[model samples]
Target chain A: MSDLRLEEINSIHFDVLKEIANIGAGNATTALSKLLDAKVDMHVPNIEFMEFKDLAEAIGGAENVVVGILLTLDTGIDGMMMFILESDSAEKIVNSLMGRTCGSLDEFSEMDLSALQEIGNIIAGSYLSAISTFTNMTITSSVPYLSIDMAGAILSVPAIEFGKISDKALMIESEFGDKDTIINGYFILIPTLEAFELIFSSLGLM
Target chain B: MGTVIKVGMADLNVCKAPDALTTLGLGSCVGICLWDSVAKIAGMAHVMLPDSTQIRNNDNIAKFADTGIKETLDRVLKLGAQKSRLVAKIAGGAQMFAFGSNNDMLRVGDRNVAASKEMLKKLGIRLVAEDTGLNFGRTIVFYPENGNLVITAVGKPSKTI
Candidate 1:
């Protein structure tokens, strides 16, 4: 077997991430459509691999973000994807789900948090599952962790962990819907070094 | 002279004698260390989450609060140090997330600190000091040579634990 190197492995990992996100976006669109009772068009705009710091900056335009991670049993086989949305967009998603035009924090119910977690769970899990299928790997995901906070704290995470694993990271930006309820998502894919090697070797692409 | 082994989230750094171990910018996370002043041996860990409940068979044992702390303690003991001589000092548990003033669920940082203290007590370890809670990031330095815990917070001077 040839030497297992990062450059050889990362390309394959990036491709798998893109294809999975492409398929998963369809799942997200369908779920949102059903939830909102309207057609929500979701598009995966860009898929690029960059450093964790760069991915953080790209998602910085938003005020509020929904961050989630989907980890598999395989140590290196985890994927993390976060949704960055302006606070207004997040409020809109909640309002639309609650069937209200505007609602205060007191008016907001636990149902709203559940609704947001459900959306994040579906999108993050679907993306990881789709990627696992393409890679011919069996992976399981934990219930997604949902947090809504300022962009800074959300962005600071990858810098500590993900950046140490890969020189550059895989990312996809998706835009969905056309109504006042436009939803945009930034999907990131960062595989550990061992997982990166396994994908390429398994695909016979190394 | 103490050697400082700086650790980060989900990471652990170990050092022996004349060494001071440390972890910085700990917020909503826990920093743990087991040090033997007489033996001048120590181990430090910075864990982001509370438990292994989120994952299974996660060999990265340093990513959780109780497991990481216990692992560090074991290592410090293995370095020719007796368990009775081991002492613990912890810092960091800042509420980094800004939420509604009434939102209790946002107290992840506070929860982490409380959980760590309780776990240590259960383990029969003496916590000589702790600088936790509040809303500021912390830089922790563990001096193994003298069992000195130097804790420095943002906008605050360094103080011994």
Candidate 2:
């Protein structure tokens, strides 16, 4: 990982990042499953080098209105962490939390929205804790902010925040959910170039 | 047989009248659509940052407000857009979330909008319409023939400016 640019990373480096994501997102799903009392399953994670434009299409498309929970990282690794879900999945998770049927995706009341944020907080908390414990780094996440909008818009914050140092983003995408397969959501982890260097070096993978 | 030209992130493109230009999922980024009514020329740029001067090795002209708008203007001008007749309609510079930590990086959306406006003013192009600054994302489809920009969002009605 020494002298490795995030934009043009090699296969081995991607594997290292992928492994970190596996453990981190793996814990995320466990936390989420416990909260919903649903047996959550996680799909294999993907690490890709993408431009800002392709990021929106990765989840669905730019026009696909989805729910996202974002947490800004600052303790050690600087970047953004996001949890995204389709409208239906978001409604399902919120409904389960409220102990009632959330009629439809578009019918979220203020209480439902807040519950979604709490869901985001819990899942992201576990994800960050896993990364910190594994790497022995002081990584911290900010309060969760929820947004339900175009995927492109939700991803823009990270693109600009890390744009000056890297043109393309090194992102890890992981999908997780329950047996009904109704809770399909993406746990997107975007770390800065410096953060990647630190992670790789700290883990002796570099 | 009309074309809907797609403009990628940190990229810009120009099209003639009866053709439209579009960019998707603009969170903290700005999508500047410039129209030359008489020539029926339209150009759109998806800029990711405010100023290129802050960083060295600023190779991509379409990634910053200052350089992106300049390059977009140049392309439209070459495509028969008269400098004096060009007017701008902008969209997509919304703060997607609020952060208690006022890190300058988190506030890039507000700065991006300000930079776009400054560049528009500097280029002496009139900003006829704008849809910007909210906690939401927008996808902009710009029609050159009528200078109408269609702004779309999730869970919200589409609007034409």
Candidate 3:
């Protein structure tokens, strides 16, 4: 077996990712429109690719880190989009939406569990599908995993603690909806050097 | 007199006497607090999203909206709050995201608000007062004794809900 040559590998540019994001976002918008029976609006305020260290700084003060699944659906789109949110933010989002007094996670009951997972699955799944089409890549996603405080663990990695995957970070802040119901989705997309190359090459801009 | 309960996000703290129920940082999220002044019983929940189907759990409670509300209500009832006398006060659910962009995902916050309202309706609890929607975050405090609610918002004025 011959070793894969770096020369033969393809990589994606930041611009390519941005374009893909635009397309993926459009797909997500269309999906939302059909679901809510209302016009869906969205925004991608900032997008950039950086190292892992930079990604950590962006997370700033996240008490508990939630790393959702790295999932792939048969919906046809490729590429991967992972959903990571601070545990506090996740709880807050659920609590506020239900119109109940905000309490700790210990207060949640059986019904709440089903609701959160359903929403998480839909948003994360749809978002990734859009990214795949925009990038024109066939990337595989794993079943989304819920990593409780994984960020802390990741940061604690011996190499990361000293700084290893410092430059594999990408961040995007997206907002949607009207005056009555506004939602913001903050996404941090990080890719390894290998993955990065594959993405750019797949888009033919590498 | 009734007991008042106050709940915080990710944590639960309740009192069975005349007290206050409060929740903060509600954006597209809901603050549901039930109070029975005569019984001096109160229960509060600060939910950030609408449901919890996405969250897989092995018995850890207070993480989802539907279960969060039900649990809080049940706790209050256990504290001697009669369902008929329970009055609901709500605040939060501001549209934190702006419109007119290219990326369009489901607005989790909005769906949350709608879900909360439906749940309340199903519970047969009359919402005495509510402060929801718009594009901002809110901090709500409820005094069960007199049915007083003080809602303070960031970058906005504090008003009673």
Candidate 4:
């Protein structure tokens, strides 16, 4: 298999990435719906090769406060996956899970944080499992690390990882939310350059 | 009131008295602010990595702490800032997420902060103040007129150094 650069990624490659994102996010959305016991809607996944500076703009702005759950792909792929939600959305999810009306995100207790982390773990597991099954790759993820910070700060982890190799990063982003409360959560997947080549060759696209 | 000039990630810029330099959402990346109070000139660089020499694609000088600080200093000097009167204040370099594993990539924040201070010392610039190496991200604005570096973080009080 030939090495693939971010700049050299063509429409066909994007289509495959999108399909992977679709399968992964579709499973995640289903898992979310089951957990929440409510119908959830997911937007078509967007695969974009973005500069490090523009990564934060995907969720609104750099300084926008967000709750981020990050996990490293330990096997089969060398990269990371992130589940990001706006502060209010995270609060809403925690409230829904615990069946309590937690007025604000600022007042999240330790239990609330743990609940959020568990939600992240479940959703991320479902997403990865779907991708692993579809591509026949044994993908395993590290324990989720949770953080509440600015979108820019949270995204910097993956951006720095990508920056080591290139100025731009290729991300597969999917947005899923509840219909009533409109709790929008973003799922971002960033595979390393070598992982991209492996994925393409696994599917005989290279 | 000065206009806020935004410095993007892995980027640098210089401005005068009435214009301030700002960079948003610095996580594991350091924002270096260099000022010549007498000249009322300021420069800011948002560096992503610790060293440029260690990487093969080192063309983007503004992407590393060592090179980024030097380039920012050069730009400010060209804008009439005196090198002898230059002082530096830095913010950002946060470990946004904590993990048990001892991966070097996760320690980029500390490395960036250390590299930045080393570069400032090598350039003969006095390191006056800093807010770094915490588990939170920071957004910083640098004003040359007063040499104040204002740092703001989520769920934390904003401070000026």
Candidate 5:
């Protein structure tokens, strides 16, 4: 695996991974739309192999303050899934759900925080569930931990784990909700090296 | 303008005074900076894990607090910084995520901070100041010119130590 270059990944393998992500995110969109009673749509997921050093760039910026929901994979694949949302977008979500328009989250109540967590849980749960069904494998996920901080900081959890060996990590990026201005965010999935191989072999792409 | 050196995650670097070094967005990972006021030399390390011994095949010395801090001190000494005059100012090692359980992973920030302090003690280094163990992230810039470490975070006022 050390000799494997991301640039040389088979196009067919990339396509399979993208399709799986799309299907999973598609289910998440439906789940979110139902929860909010608002129309939710997703753009085509852009999947690529990214270097650990560039992880912050992949999100927005190193110092960019954002809301993140990270879930650790427990079974089938040892990996991580993160939901990244801009501050205003997250505030927009909280307001829309609570039926109150908020200009800021500095005074956000406990319920407000939990609402965001629940939203993260629902979306990630549905996405992982879809992937599990498609692959016919068990993919257990830990509780979603929500945080609001610099994009680099939020992403460091996985970056640290992968940086020890591989310089690159496979990144799947998808956007959901408003495409114009507010109410937009990204969903990212990173599988461990062994799991990466497992995914390819499971899909017969290897 | 001083040459600003950027230290990537789980990495380490050294620089002389009149120059600067930085590490961005530390969360559950500590950015350890050692500086010699007289020599005007500084070394910065972005450490991810507390100990390298727990993990097999640990090839990156800069990823662990024990080795990273030790190596940074050694490198700084080689660059004309006297060990006796060295002092430490650290930042980061934030919990980042708030969870209700006592799970060890969630307490990584606390553990990292403790490990860093322990390593500093073993190396006979004095920790003059620190900004750590919160539910927020930090970006730190170290200036060896005056042994000042500037810490910046979103929606928070920047501070210098």
Candidate 6:
């Protein structure tokens, strides 16, 4: 690894990051499809080097209410993984899981919240596992922490973590949607700079 | 008829009366608002970290509570506002997620709030009103014309202070 920095990440680095996102999100989408028993489609992953100001806008608007599932990567990569869904999409997924309809995010019961966390746990687990297998690294994540709030606010958690080291964050983002309901969810992965170095060395990219 | 000036994360700006300052999605970030009622000048800083001295990447002064507040105060004073007449109102700094880990980053909201207050005190800026330290995110708009800080959040009632 040639001293990789957020500002110095080139197209080749982006292409490799995109591939990681593709494989990770692909596996995650499969798990989601199985859990929902519905067809789920994923868009091509995007590698974004974004300022903190633009991070919130990536999910529509800063004030837009969202359901965020956060997990800390500990073992092989010291970083964070987040699963974000629009309020309506979250509600839809929860309702489907419970075989019933829920009104809004504000009215989500304890059971509903638990169900959402489980969904995040499974999807994030699959995503990390895919990356670990591809990179041949041991990656483990903490239990999912669920938060229902503004997208900007929820996104700040990752932004602050990244801001400590760099002005901009290199994010691997993927969008997954359920065909029947057209519900969309976003999965974002942010690895520390050191983690990136490890990944590149493991893959012989450096 | 005043335009709304946006303050992005880790950024700060100053505006005069009729012009309001606003910042969106303050999660674990503090929005420090300084106002000069006599001159109708207002400034807002969206600070992400508690202290700049603790971080190696400290080029952006506005990214830290200590430096961000001082810089904002300087800007407002330069805009024909008297330092003695400046008052402050702050918002944001909410714990957006509940985590069991004892990581300092997770408690950054509280630290940001504390650091902001400390800076304001050092500058002799009276913190008249504050809406902070909760488990939610806030979007704030500050009107220097009336020294009002309007706060809004998801599933929560909007309030003005």
Give all TM-scores, in the order shown.
0.54, 0.93, 0.45, 0.95, 0.87, 0.95
Task: For model 5, state the Cα shift of residue A165 in Å.
Answer: 5.3
Q: In candidate 6 chain A, what residue range of length 10 has the lowest lDDT sum?
A: A171-180
| Per-residue alpha-carbon lDDT of candidate 5 for residues B50-154, written as tens digits (9 for 90 to 100) | 888976546788989999999999999999999999999889888777665755567777778899999999999999999998888899999999888999988
Model 2 residue B54 distance off true place after TM-score fit, in angstroms: 1.5
**Candidate 3: regions farther than 4 A off:** A1-206, B1-6, B10-13, B54-60, B99-106
What is the C-alpha local distance difference test score of each model?
A: 0.63, 0.83, 0.54, 0.86, 0.82, 0.86
Q: All models, DockQ values? A: 0.05, 0.76, 0.01, 0.83, 0.54, 0.84
Error of 4 at B95 (Å): 0.8
lDDT of 3 by residue, A36-121 (tens): 56676877645755443344345552123343322323233322345545556556556655656576554556566444555555
Interface RMSD of 6: 0.8
Number of the candidate with higher TM-score, 5 or 6? 6
In model 2, where do residues sit more than 4 Å from their true spots? A1-4
By lDDT, the better pick of 3 and 4 is: 4
lDDT of 2 by residue, B127-153 (tens): 999999888898889988888999988
By DockQ thresholds, what CAPRI class is model 1?
incorrect
Model 5 spans with C-alpha error above 4 angstroms: A1-12, A100-102, A178-183, A204-206, B100-102
How large a fraction of the reference contact set does each model reproduce? Answer: 0.02, 0.84, 0.00, 0.83, 0.61, 0.86
Candidate 4 residues B46-127, lDDT tens each? 9999899988678899999999999999999999999999999989889988877676667888889999999999999999
lDDT of 5 by residue, A70-111 (tens): 888889988788788888888888888888866476777889
Deviation from native of the Cα of residue A54 in model 6, angstroms: 1.1
- Best DockQ among the predictions, by candidate number: 6
Model 2 chain A lowest lDDT segment of ten:
A1-10
Residue A181, candidate 1: alpha-carbon lDDT: 66
Give the least accurate 10-residue stretch of model 1 chain A, judged by summed lDDT. Answer: A62-71
